[model samples]
Target: MTLLAGTWDGVYRTTGPRFDAAEQVLDCGRVLRVRQFDAFDGVFAATKSGLYHSTDDGDSWTDLDVPREEVYSVVGSPDGDRLYAGTHPAHLYVSESGEEREDDSRSWRELESFQDLPSREEWYTPRHRNEAHVRSLGAHLDVPERVIAGVEVGGVHVSDDRGETWEERKDGVHDDVHHVLVRGPDHYVASCGGGLYRTRDAGESWTRLDDSLDQTYFREAFAHDGVLYAAAARSSPGTWRGERGADAALFESVDDGDSFDVVEYPGHPEEVVLSWTVGDDTIVAGTNDGGVILRDGGEWVEGGRVEAGVAALCAL
Candidate 1:
């Protein structure tokens, strides 16, 4: 079953080029932040107001009852029966029933604090509702107890009891983390304002890996076929505008996050944001501009472009 995508104003089926704006699945106003669209069971979106779910192939959506609207990220369990939503002003919300929010059976499970990391209220600073956005999330395939959340202003948080309690990993990680990816049993990568960083000790300590990459804005990172890939955008020193400057191509890092090699695309180096590996060899990249590019085999194909821009992409 192929999934659908389009501008924030509309939604489209992946099998065709035509789009139906009537089926604009997600709302942009109430949702201050939206992340993690799982196309298999449904799409999971987090907003500053609350959480939303779209199950009718992105035709419509419902809001999940959450404590706060400042949700940074949403992660689904391997079974797709439940989801873990992380909020800024730091809070963890769990939905045991991963169904439409309209479903009354769904309940919100809030997790208590973990480790000696400062509480969310203690680190309260004025920033965008999304400023403390949960930048990245990953669940261990082999170890079900392990879950990780990368916060923008805060460092990393790990939950071993499936979101029951959280612990902050403050060793070698930068306080400002842009994204995170779990590579293996003992390794993880984080992209930050400083550059690419790797931690062999489960985020306890990190090592900088920016020497091979041109100093640019590291927007997003992901893993595919056991190879690490990061997407970055070249920016002007003053303001972060892609229209006035050239963006960087995608990069591949084979040896964990130590180094990188830029991947070539069809157009001039354009910036790409969120991406996901659909199959063993397919990658779908969502660009800042409302465009989607699919990488199959050794080539890239333009899926479509939306005026409002592409926020995120995931395989169905």
Candidate 2:
């Protein structure tokens, strides 16, 4: 098995139960997401530099030239005909042609209607000098035309027409969204700085899932094999540098978010698990402190270490 770690410095790859000797494969900066979609070929990386595609198992990468240099999120249409790239300024772009096209022939058109959201002017974050970003994008095969977007400091929004027009869904959820995990056409889990939220009617409403837990600042949520996993810090990243470090905890839900049970891992309280992927029969988690952990024999154990903090992960 091969594991790809997207970090602040670049992208690294390792084929082992340990990542101590992981090698850098791509130099794209601040990789926010490394994912693979059944509708699309190869692996996609969303980075501060741009969007990249790797076909030969992370051996080489090709820039998709998304126009915007800082791509925070990328997703493919359910039909695999279109590719979406969300940028730092909260702009959305779509490529009708897949990334397999040549660089000179590939084109991406801005989804201008995205700026027409009624709350567009309010999508600013003080951390980014009043600039916000589209931190998460999600699409489900059950709803081919529906596209869900979670914006940092902005809110959650849905576009039924596939990025052409949008409806505000963040009314009941916190605006400091980090990731949106889609389980079905109407089911989604939003990880935000304020709380973790769940929606059943396609984001028309949301319920907080972490009211009983101490950790509130969630970065991402993942669901696999009927199990839900979420890791969160006590507060925002600003408080992650103190003596307690991130003070983070990992939560698991087997009953689909109705309740959660805190699970212990190798790096508890200090190193937050920032990314997750599945390799073979093992569940893999990467941490902000460069720790690689695996779930073996139904328990979390230390697997290895990478050179830099892993922001995203993909297993092939």
lDDT of each: 0.61, 0.91
Clashes of 1: 4
Root-mean-square deviation of every model? 4.0, 1.3
Candidate 1 lDDT, tens digit per residue, 1-316? 3444533443334543322222345654333234443423566565555666666656666676777766657777665556777776666767775444446325777765632356453333355454455656777566566788877667777777777777778567666666677776457788775567788877777787776677556656788776777876654223435475555667877877667877776443754554443533467666655566667666667655555555455444
Model 2, 1-316: lDDT tens digits are 9989999889999987668789999997789999998987899999999999988999888888898999999999989888999999999999995444645325889999889999999999889879999999999999999999999989999999988989999889999999999999999999999999999999999999999999999999988899999999999878888788999999999988989999999989899988998878688999998899998887899989887898999998
The C-alpha stretches of model 2 lying farther than 4 A from their native spots are 98-101
Best by lDDT: 2
Candidate 2 accuracy as TM-score? 0.97
Give the lowest summed-lDDT range of ten residues in model 2.
97-106
TM-score, each model? 0.80, 0.97
Model 1 lDDT vs. the true structure?
0.61
